[model samples]
Target: MQVDVAILIIIYAYVTTLVVLWFLMKVRPKFPSGISIGIVVFLGIATTMAVVTILEFAIAPVGRPASRVISIARGLKIAAIEETMKLIVAALGILIAKNEAKWVDTKLSLAFVSGFTFGITEALFYVARNSYSLFGLVNLFLSRLIHPVFTVSLVGGILLFRYGKRIEGVLVASYSYLGHALLDHYLTACACYISSAVILLALASFAGAVYLLMPKIEAERKQRGEFEKEATVELKDHWLNKM
Candidate 1:
């Protein structure tokens, strides 16, 4: 019986990896396989966790909150902090890669990979505490997938800024931050007060949202690359003509 269960778990892991890889291919055709991109993801995760640790220490301590409203407010602050962290790390990673003069594929791949690292790291930490049983896997995966995808959804803002769309980038980044905060607020608040079933649905919703939006991001990323290349060429030609 134990052997049978073990075999089943192995099979499940294999299937899960294949499915995840398939979806990843859809969202990013050549992602989860790039070494440098994986490095950026690792760095992004490290940066986010380290910075958040400092932020928490710097912030004032609050006693057990007086009301649900206060608790909710604190949760919202957490969301803001985390969402901001993702943006900052992701943008920083992109800039660093750009400064290195990596191609558009590397730059574009880093954004999503970094965002995914953040989410998967979060999932891993939670799973460590809970330890997985069959019942826990779905909740575990969904919960882990949501936030990174949230950040992935907003990678457009950072990409735009990289392409000289400063105003648009800031606007989109702000919107992304607010949306992340709201989603986190809702999920955290409900999880505290509601059933696991609702939490499951919320997780699924967030993941679905990311899956649906990825193609559009692919379009935007492609279009922005073309625009930036054109501008760069124009600048180069102008300088050469002047010389």
Candidate 2:
């Protein structure tokens, strides 16, 4: 009902960063099949919401940040639910393609594609239910946009697991979850101290991280033939789609 420092900063930074991501993804990017992407999007929204709702009710006395311990606990719970639900959708193609000896481009693409769609779908619902005004739009950016952007950070992590980097994969996965959880916790419990500058800084840092790892993901994409036939040779990191 009320906008706070954290809310304002999140909205502004998210909207700006999303614009940048759109531009980056425009670079002769290879998109997923229409049917596959559509299925993943539907799966992402339906499963994520359904499972989150079930968990919320099952837990009861949901974390309201009455205390730091409670806040962290709640934040971890939320992170666990979100990560697991998203992964479930991402795993579909992989599970079906498990028998294939060769690499499946579509399976790998599923990770980011599902992530991107899930972020947008969730954002739309959140805006409609909470606020559809300017404030609502900002909320959508924060709540919806960030999830997919953050999940893009998982490209390396997923690859690590796909290839034989078990330890590294676990480490990356852990870091990703903690990073996502910490952001949520801070926004929920420490909103009063957050600022637009801080939000911008976080987004800039994330964009930089994406820029750094995109090459590795694209390298794999190319090796696996996951990209469109027509594309730019040099890939520059603009923002996020990494879904």
Candidate 3:
């Protein structure tokens, strides 16, 4: 049953990734290169492995204990580790891209992919460790979907930092970390009363980040189209001269 649960979540993640890619490609004229997307996905998986390793060794492992405080602490630790890893990997992905300006055009999508992959990887780990019913695993998968928001927030923050808005960058990044910690803490502690509030807040943040990125994405798309037009014109002139 647990194995079935894991398979189901994995299938869902795969389909979700493809759908997102298709949607972005349809709506945007410019997208990140395949290599850049590949790197981000690889980094996302590596980030998950790093987190699991640290949790298993460096951090005090949290078992199925009855203590709420311990559970909260575990959650905080998880947030700290996972957020740090996501930030690092996201930045690394940007750095690895050959054309930073081109990457900026589809930064949000790349960030989403990274976070989505990371979240799914983490969820699979939990699925392996625990025996969950089909419904329970589905719920877990849904909750894990919030992860892309955190990554998008972090990437936006990093962009702000690079563009000289250091304070705002820090604040935005802090917001992502805070939302992630709260969700994890409440979920792990089984504080049902507050979970709904936390989830709503996280969703709101996700919506805001996407809203903020949309204008920038459109602007970049226009700019890229103009650049392509100019390039085609130049190529045509060169061909005429050759003829």
Candidate 4:
């Protein structure tokens, strides 16, 4: 019982701290007013819950006592459902708020928050419904941590779309889904007493995902910086004219 409490506390603390930091440093200043930002945050959380519920129902048809091939297919299906829902939610959020101008600044941050919420919520749900030993708990924690990286690919797709590369954007976005499916495949393989070297493939895939995501983040950050500079100049001009 004590162990479970400690695990819960650790998970909560980690999640809360990351969220608070993102909100304060990344999200808060990007919006025009508190109310708008609140709406975005609320929608993100709601989207996470919706995704989790949908995934549970969607995967139920996969059933149990599966062969290795069937297990891998299930994993791919899970990845497809999750990544699709996330991408759709993020895209909808962008379209609904895209006219704000500030919406572009929040794109990456919002995606991160949504993905973070999804991963943590899904992890907690898994913890609640299953028993885990110490090693298993550690593995679960590590696995959940990587889950958010998939959103980085979504952001890349969004960026490309905004830049008028629709087809390329879609293919780039699907990268996350494929990466996620690969990780799930290896994990399922390991569970079935397959050679553990497959874990290396998972790690490599994660590293590759991160590598692919970095340039997109850098591009977004540079663009946001430019936007802030322009806004600052405009505000100064307005004050000077008023004077």
Global lDDT scores for all candidate models: 0.51, 0.54, 0.64, 0.54
Candidate 3 residue spans exceeding 4 A from truth? 1-31, 56-65, 68-74, 100-103, 160-170
lDDT of 2 by residue, 144-187 (tens): 55555455445446656556766756556665566556666555
What lDDT tens digits, residue by residue, belong to model 3 across residues 123-203? 787777767778767756765666776777777777766667677667676778786676656544544446556655555
Model 4 TM-score, 2 decimals = 0.58
Best-matching candidate per lDDT: 3
RMSD of 3: 6.1
TM-score of candidate 2 to 2 decimals: 0.63
The global Cα lDDT (0 to 1) of model 2 is 0.54
TM-scores vs. true structure, each candidate: 0.52, 0.63, 0.76, 0.58
Off by over 4 Å in 1: 1-35, 48-72, 99-106, 160-172, 191-243
- Candidate 2 lDDT for residue 33: 49
- Residue-by-residue lDDT tens digits, candidate 4, 1-243: 355334433432354344435434533424334443455456656766776676562211112333443355676787787776666655555555665534444665455555665666676677777777786666455545444456645675656666676775676566667656654664433332221233233334333433444565457668778999999999999999999
Judge candidate 3 at residue 78 and give its lDDT. Answer: 76
